[model samples]
Target: MNFCLPYSATRRVLAAALACAVTLPVAAAFAAQAPAPATLRLDYLHTGNASTEQYAIERVVIEPLPWPGNMARTVDDTDRGVNKVEVVDKASGKLLYSRGFSTVFNEWRSTAEAEKVNRGFEESVRFPKPDHAVTVRILKRDENNAFTLAWSTELDPDAPDVVRKQEPSALRPIPIRVSGPSPDKVDLLILGDGYTAGEMKKFEATARRMADQLFSVSPFRERAGDFNVWALAAPTPESGVSRPSTGVHHASRLGTRYDIFGSERYVLATDNRALRELAQNAPYEFIEIIVNNDTYGGGGIFGQFSTAAANSDWAKYLFIHEFGHHFAGLADEYYTSPAVYQPSGARVEPWEPNATALRDPANVKWKKFVAAGTALPTPWPKAEFEAYSRDIQQQRVALRKAQRPESEMSALFKRELAHEEELFSRAPNRHAVGAFEGANYEATGYYRPQLQCMMFDRSEQFCTVCQDAISTIIDLYSRPAPH
Candidate 1:
């Protein structure tokens, strides 16, 4: 874990510790001057039905890479996720390390299937290894929107049961962008799935292209220097991932595929263990999975991972839009699209930084950005928008029902975006930060920050509120907290 050793000594020690021939570009002045602790991961099982949930310890792992986070900013104050993990000193109950993240299990709980079935999901939380035992607590928001303790367990990084060593990975991380030491930069790993050895070059090129696409946006473009991007992939036996809806299935390294939760375009890797195992080889705080397919599909979960179809015509938009969810827990601002989650009868304020229930219009969550005279429930072309969206939705369903070409779907999306842009442009509050009524998959209660955003539609940039939310996380990983 010590990075203060001489260049030669550090190289030898790091090489020995990794159990692999691959070397990171960390033997430099910053590393030689600082000390970074080893990374510790707590793998656990999150299981339950719609009404009940439980957590159990699976195993602890000491990852080969050091902790890729700002040592001074170990506590997450953003409060952006449905769940939060806190590492506390067992003896003194002092908080050590904490982070906010969402799990697939929580997402599944909202599905109608969860009412009749109980399921389990593998989940993991990583932190800098502490010197002593710590009580890891998982907190979930109650009806009142406060984090209440859900589960707790004691763990010692030095315990004999801890996994201290791992078999070397056949895959090596390719440096797409090297800003600085990982501790001082947001380490983003671009992982590829469903890519064969013959398509390795294609995967790397796609990864680079996606990384470039991500940084072309507002917040990322302005703060490009505060990030380090790495690419890694375990070559699959064949190309393209499983898409059950279309009856296309292929073996993939990460087990990521399309048609998750019965949504045809929704893609996700339910294998958390596989994802963490491959990702542990690289220095990463956030992950963006790029599946080798031309289908327009991708998905994201807060503080966990995002995915995009690397060869899709809307690849750039998917790469950044899904990252909005995975990177900063930005909620989907659009409501017309069909989603897997069942409609909630209650109107509780969402934990996402973007969307809200708007119970108190005078004091909306993003109130500061609201103009002096702007209306609370900012009026837009709602009726027209919804009508247009319904027609487009029908067309979308027909395209999928008939198994139409992807190009046709892409063309439909282009038209939809064009119609939306023209409609919103004529609205009075198109650029206002007032609450636009319609977000989080609900057309009634939830509201968004602006008339349009990446989370809302196929837009190129995030709204002002979303950009601010993203900047908060960027600062959390890239620099020390203000004293």
Candidate 2:
């Protein structure tokens, strides 16, 4: 008894106490923490003309609390938390097929920033019926472990009535070509502007026609099986109202009054406050901006947007041409005319598939096609070619002046001197000569290899250059083979 317990016993007792001291608190901490869970429910509402889908959900997002406010903030902020949620069809449950989206709190308030985010989010969600209805609700997880709904709104999928004014013909699917990368399906989104409103039937017809024309094109024709078209019908004319004859002659420093180029900036979705909202609903690799006006003029910017005058007979051509610009980055081969914006003299290389400065001639992208004898700054054939050259120059001036109706001018040129037929012939001085009538940029001076091409002029076919560009674009956006 006088002898203390052995030193080993004393050391063992201290070690056990220390281990318990560290282990117990960790166990207690884990016991105190809890995992968060979230769930959402969807209900489909089919309104006669339009359908609506509603999503209801309550979610809890736990973030690490900082400093003194951590525990207290978690308790107070529990009421403020929002659930992030999305709803998809039961059959196609992929996120890409989600029809409804909802987010809690104003994470981004800036208009431009919000627009960008909204666009991205919209692109990510694809409703089974884009023209169906949708509704979203955000709720807080209450202390009782129940969803206390805070906000809710139903989205209307305004489906237009397929009113058959006449006997319903067989619904013929429009044929389209596919040459680029192989996609599971072609995602086509057609945006309706003022032109689509009054002429719903015509708009649909034109859309179908365009789809057919697209199928006729190469590469797209090859991949016709993998395409779908979605039209976002807005209440607008397919072509703008014809400007009064008096207004036609009014010229501005910018250009002719008939040059209603800037009208595109004003076109917006009527139902949806923002274009991104509609774009988000149906994400498209190609967006066809159909205007209501008929007086022909359209634009395309690669990887950006393609616009068309809905009413022109050549509307189909404009659609494809601008699409080439928006989708393929093809350049305007005809160059003698002026542009809305002049190059800043900065050493810039165009991003289009056709046309080049030969800045690095040896490594030019289309170098393989340049003939062996073709010289840089290709020589302008001499004065003997002056007649053709003069014709081209005169037409270019007329085009810039917006002096005559395009149809009348084209018809006049076609009848005179057989310019239309000879435009693309491969004579010794063919590519080297004066103006060629059908060239896209110039009325008569520059000659394209083909008499008719989507780029050079409407009422013609797409040339080899345009075809190649279309093929390249199709390839770029297509999904690659899996590794």
Write candidate 2's Cα lDDT for 220-299 as tens digits.
67756555565655443223433434252321111112333223212212221134333433324456767665555666
Error of 1 at 237 (Å): 0.9
**lDDT of model 2, residue 117:** 35
- Would you estimate the TM-scores of all the predictions? 0.95, 0.49
Which regions of candidate 2 deviate over 4 angstroms? 1-183, 196-198, 237-273, 370-420, 429-453, 456-466, 479-483
- What TM-score does prediction 2 earn? 0.49
Model 1: pairs clashing at backbone N, Cα or C within 3 Å: none
Deviation (Å) of 157 in candidate 2 = 25
Q: What C-alpha lDDT do the candidate models reach, one value each?
A: 0.88, 0.40
Residue by residue across 335-435, what tens digits does model 1's lDDT show? 99999999879999988989999989999998989989998888899999999999999999999999999999999999999999999889999898998
The candidate that wins on TM-score is 1
TM-score of candidate 1 versus the correct structure, residues matched by position: 0.95
